[model samples]
Target: MRDRIVRRVILPVAVAAALSAVAGCSLSGGTGSHKGPAAPSGSAAGRADPQAAAALRGVEQATVRAGSARIESATAMGGMLSLRTDGALGWSGDPVGTLRITYTGGQLAATMRALSSTSLEARLLPDAYYAKVGDTFARRLQGRHWIRYGYGDLAALPGGSGAYLTDQLRDTAPLQPVRLLRACGDVRRVGEETVRGRRTTHYAGTITPAALGGADAAGLRERLEQAGVTRESVDIWVDDRGLLVKKVERGELISGRMSATAYYRDYGVKVSAGRPPAADTADFRELLSTRGS
Candidate 1:
């Protein structure tokens, strides 16, 4: 059973299909490539508007010096897991690039620029991202490889074909904090509480975008069906300073908990737009290519 589960997860059926559509290649075949959209319009409008309920989202995005948060969750399977992300705000470790996320109007745009570091190791893997460490004197580098497999597609909204992944992005928007106000949803403060010894403000809400309707909606439904999973509500916990501390959510293929802790560790006050120096894909390409080769 363990082996079967591993295999199933290794080649998430939904991901495989999505890749095939975009790359025209299967995970078993390394002949796939991803082409971005021809330049999206209406983004300006999207960024200008803020959802009515998430006014406090701005406070959460303020410059966080240093902090940490914990996440304790009960899965649909009755399993419990706890996780943490240290240095969430904007703490520049020993040396290297800087990861920043800022809100424009009401939209959240992030930029991972080259920091005072060298020997940086940034890669866009099959489903996630990783950056290497370096020194200050090194020239800053940046670029966009592709949509993070683990994160939602920023180019599109959470609906219509592949809504599963898009929805996942919006669900965890609080983790970035910038989207608290930009994301279209109803959020209510669930009062204050202490999580993992740190005092945090808890918020509960549901996101149902009317944009997720019409014939186009069928595409999203189909993608979910391919994954053998359904969409679920997302719950979040934020610190007293309004920063996101934790998020609990379930998606079609994967469900887990993500948390941030440590002073401005992985978190950033604001972000810039434009591509980075170069894209990273060595790790994921290696993982997929080795097997295929």
Candidate 2:
């Protein structure tokens, strides 16, 4: 009976945590406000402040040039999940890194106590994300300490947004927020501010997926709409070196309010990740189908 209860509570929590992580790492969100134009429905052709646009473009190019950075981030998804992730991310090609994710609060945190775990290590690769389980659940998992979630398989998830998440996971870099804000076409320099003791120029704007360009623009819009992401306010802090030092994204998700704050530093930092041993890893999709494998 206890095993049954454990299975029921733990699986859902895992799913919730995974999905929230998807949204959190997914490209493009920001916080704070500005006097930008109202978010457009389906066009990035809205009147744009050319000067601000150029400035952000410079930031985007600078960030892209740096290639990698150490990131510390906190994310909240309604009342379902709250986590802090610390790691380094490299984005020259596909993003790859390892992060220690600690459950800070919310439902998932409470349920994680069932396994005596409130934290996990996530390794992000080009095609999948791997979760490392601690010893508490390793015994039950047949000494399997890793669970693999393929981005391709996640696309098959119920909501269409899962596909969007898949795409973002494969292609997004830390500089993605800058590109998204540039797509907003009305981004503005919000003045100067100090972030973590470093002087930075603040920039903020509001955007909708439909108002964005690039491949799959329409599909991205539709998926985000399904997720209840209509408009997101984005704030980025750039240091004198023209790199993103801090960013905050705030918006409403289907579940409720969703927000994230991330700080970046040590640009050009070497980032590394390696796949967990195949023999000791479980595919989460397979586990879901085979009654937790």
Candidate 3:
């Protein structure tokens, strides 16, 4: 009876966690908001510059609290994450482990793992962290923990870094069309929304890049699809400053079971910006420089 329970329940739970890691990583960053004018029919007729379009979709810096996030995967399972600026991060439906991130500046990092059904072990260190599942070293890097854990964990970190990366890529000016050609599968203006009482424009799209900055493009794409990248929806809330105040996402894996939502605040972040993930350009360079044998 004990073995059976562990196999049917515990093992599946762990697998879900592993899968969550993948989905969560991609969905991390800002919340989705605002609906913009329709993209022109052809690439030639549309706003030729994506950066300016992105800037037009940005928000200003401010601090917000009482944030919540949830994710569902089509194949394995689903999970949710919540946080209050003054309180600890909370999670539900966690399988492998629970992860909590700490943010000091615009940059963020952490270490997380599954402890049990209702509990997790997390160390949100800003500079460097060590992660392991059982005895296996999961990751040890100067990169963002979200990049390491996949998408689920990425949904919990502070700042809107994930959204930042996506927007940066999606809105690359002059070559916005080119950027979209190679970096994304499709783009659209979802609509508008109210984020923290502020009206903003919203946008959604898919990332089908040949290679992620730090992952196996093919394998990662499969993982993302399993985690709900099929109709991968990204909502960006853009204000005057062009800063992403909120980013919302709904990811579906194999069976489309896991979905997540995250909101960011305390913008104009100057502290953590120069730290790890953001500051460590050299680290990313090294990772990319590695020969893929």
Candidate 4:
């Protein structure tokens, strides 16, 4: 009985399939991607308005100074899979957080329900994502409920999705959109708007990583290209205090349309995510190796 259970988890097909569903692809349409101005090409790339450039620079600074915050985010792809995450994340240094990630609607959600769960407790450390299995499979996992996917191992995976996932896990944070805005440099200030009852200045831009040039240009282009993202539309809301209150980034992928919306609050919050016990955890790479053998 133990051997059978071990075999089932060695490959962890269900978990791997769920990863593929979102793996760097928010690829979606309805969430306002088409409504915005498309990215300019050729000579029009980085000529952002002076005021807009300055504002984004301030935004980048403000958000980075805030250090950490509570985040609620939802992402969907091609109308097929949607998921949400709620947690506090610390980005003062290496990103870290503990999030309850729920697969809300999708064929994958159905499979999770069949397994008696649609949510997973994920600990996001600087180097890896540790997903805690549900009770239904904990016994079968032999009291080992955690599965570790190291970012380096993920980057080594053959597909572009893995590299994309690596980029997302490693470089992603509330500060990402702001950085992208500064990098894209063709930002437009869309005046003021109310967000979650707070007044905010709306800003929008299109990002084509390859068109950008600077210290950040090469890394952005390489990471994005490896993820199969040709271009993206991003928008952000910054409050009077210059903190990012919300952001929307949408783009297309070979599989479908992708969209993600995130809200930030409770800035300066103290965040902690201690590692799982090694005895109660399994490294996904090790599991793959064992299965292959």
By lDDT, rank the candidates, best first: 2, 4, 3, 1
Per-model TM-score, in order, reads 0.36, 0.79, 0.38, 0.79
Error of 1 at 127 (Å): 14
- lDDT head-to-head 1 vs 4, winner: 4
Better of 1 and 2 by lDDT: 2
lDDT at position 284, candidate 2: 67
As for candidate 2, its clashing pairs are 30-233, 30-234, 30-248, 30-249, 30-250, 31-248, 31-249
Candidate 4: RMSD to truth: 5.5
Full-model lDDT for every candidate? 0.30, 0.67, 0.31, 0.66
RMSD for each of the candidates: 15.6, 5.6, 14.5, 5.5
Q: Which ten residues in a row have the lowest lDDT in candidate 4?
A: 22-31
Where in model 3 is the C-alpha error above 4 Å?
A: 1-24, 27-121, 126-182, 206-229, 269-293
Please, what are the lDDT tens digits per residue for candidate 2 over residues 1-293? 44344443444344333433332333222222332333332224344666777887788788779888887778776666677877776778886877777888776677666566678887878878877876777666677888787877777867465566566555435555676677765577777889899999887777677677654456546645655676676778889888888887777554456677888889998888999999999786765564433
Best by lDDT: 2
> Can you write out model 3's per-residue Cα lDDT over 1-293, one digit (the tens) per residue?
43233322332223223222322344332222322222222233322335433443222111111112222222212332222122122121121212332221111111112321222223123322212222211122333232122232333334544333322222111112212322343444545677788776564454433332222345455434433343344445555444444544444333333233444343322221112243322222233334422
87 Cα displacement, candidate 1 (Å): 9.3
Model 1 Cα shift for residue 230 (angstroms): 5.5
